[model samples]
Target chain A: MELASSNYIETIGFIAAFLTTAAFLPQVFKTWKTKDVSGLSFSMLLMFFVGVFLWLVYGYYKESPSMIMANTITLGSAFLLIYFKITYRKK
Target chain B: MELASSNYIETIGFIAAFLTTAAFLPQVFKTWKTKDVSGLSFSMLLMFFVGVFLWLVYGYYKESPSMIMANTITLGSAFLLIYFKITYRKK
Candidate 1:
């Protein structure tokens, strides 16, 4: 009973983190198709990327399976955002 | 040595998670002030909010402090996004 309850909790966290991290997909796809990051804020993307890197480090240190798993996806997504920022950034 | 290594790893993950999770603050602040989620995608936010809830549940079940902490912040930020979405959604 206890183990099942514990597993449920972990599963829920994974699902939540996974969904949000994956949420960037549409934006990334849009940006890729449109090649327009004019609507996207460079500062925010920059900060987000940095933050993901920190999370990756944190996850590594903490040895958290879910955190690492979620952040890995986040880092990849954020990287795409960075690419879009650089590719489409306005002068 | 092993303990220190483990500790360092966890700390890095925490820092990373903390920074990235907080990265949404500026956007949240901006959206709150400007009431603009026009550029933000609705489906994405919906997915994100749902995901965070799952993560919260996961964290609760697993009893992981850092995951819980990070997800809590994420949930709040995502909530703000939801509010902005409803407030500024197009007619």
Candidate 2:
């Protein structure tokens, strides 16, 4: 019973991780394709990046595979958005 | 010794929760103020909202206070962003 419950929790974690991590892709793609960053907030992206990085660290300490994996991908996506925000900025 | 170590982990979790949850404020503020949905992606917001909501459920199952608190705040912010995206859409 305990094993089955634990498995259920892991499944939830996996799905949650997948959804949250994959969620950033569309923004990254839209930003990349449109190169329109007028609506993107620089401070939000910077703070999000830092926060995700810290989540990665926390996941490591907690030995949570899902958190580590999700945050790693999220960190990369956030970083790319930041880059695009800067690179595509209209001068 | 173990208690000290556990406290350290809790501290990290708290800070991580705070940063990740609070990080959404700037974007919310910017979008509300500028009414610019040009750079925002609808799919991303939708996906993120669902994902964050799932994370909240997972946190509930896991009984993690930090995760619950963080996701609750983030979910609200994500929802606001989505509302702004729809409300501010250029017709």
Candidate 3:
């Protein structure tokens, strides 16, 4: 790809990264507020958390800013969900 | 980064991508079987679907097989979630 086109694609990737990763915030907030995680699948959260961590490592290796930033934020959200899954389940 | 190191990182990225994307399967299966979407957020699904679509485009541009494969699977899962959210909610 041409340099200019490559830059454009990177821009698109960044936007996509932001949207997908940030999409987790509402779930975290809702669970935090309602303390309701009855609907969440624990296996999914656990698996996703591990996946995000590896993605962070991959981001560092690849030196992609969007991947790094997105995965960091996503890791936070995934962690919150896991926490909610553990804590809210007891209640 | 050295080419060998970059290749290793991409391998890691593919593994992460597979785990994260495949993580959605359980939710989709559960929802399909039980049709329970009460815990799912519509906005999140919508946002994520769009994000995944863009990621697909990004994958094509960047020539990342992992991104393409992962986003394609993720997009399907996201779409199913959205469909379940719509169809199962009425009952």
Comparing 1 with 2 on DockQ, the higher-scoring candidate is 1
Indicate the TM-score of model 3: 0.88
Stronger candidate by TM-score (2 vs 3): 3
TM-score: model 1, chain A: 0.80
Model 3 residue B33 lDDT score: 96
Candidate order by decreasing lDDT: 3, 2, 1
What would the per-residue lDDT of candidate 1 be over residues A31-85, giving only the tens digit for each residue?
A: 8998888767777777788877776666555445676788788889888888878
Clashes of 1: 19
Model 2 pairs whose backbones collide: none
Q: What is the C-alpha lDDT profile of model 2 across A1-91, one tens digit per residue? A: 2433766876777788998888878878877998988767788788789888887887777666778889999998999999999898988
What tens digits encode model 3's per-residue C-alpha lDDT throughout A1-91? Answer: 3534667877887999988987878888998999988878898888899999898887676666777888899999999899889988964
On DockQ, who's better, 1 or 3?
3
lDDT of 2 by residue, B30-49 (tens): 78998987777788788889
Runs in model 3 with CA error above 4 Å?
Answer: A1-4
DockQ of each: 0.61, 0.54, 0.67
Specify the highest-DockQ model's number.
Answer: 3
The count of residue-pair clashes in candidate 2 stands at 0
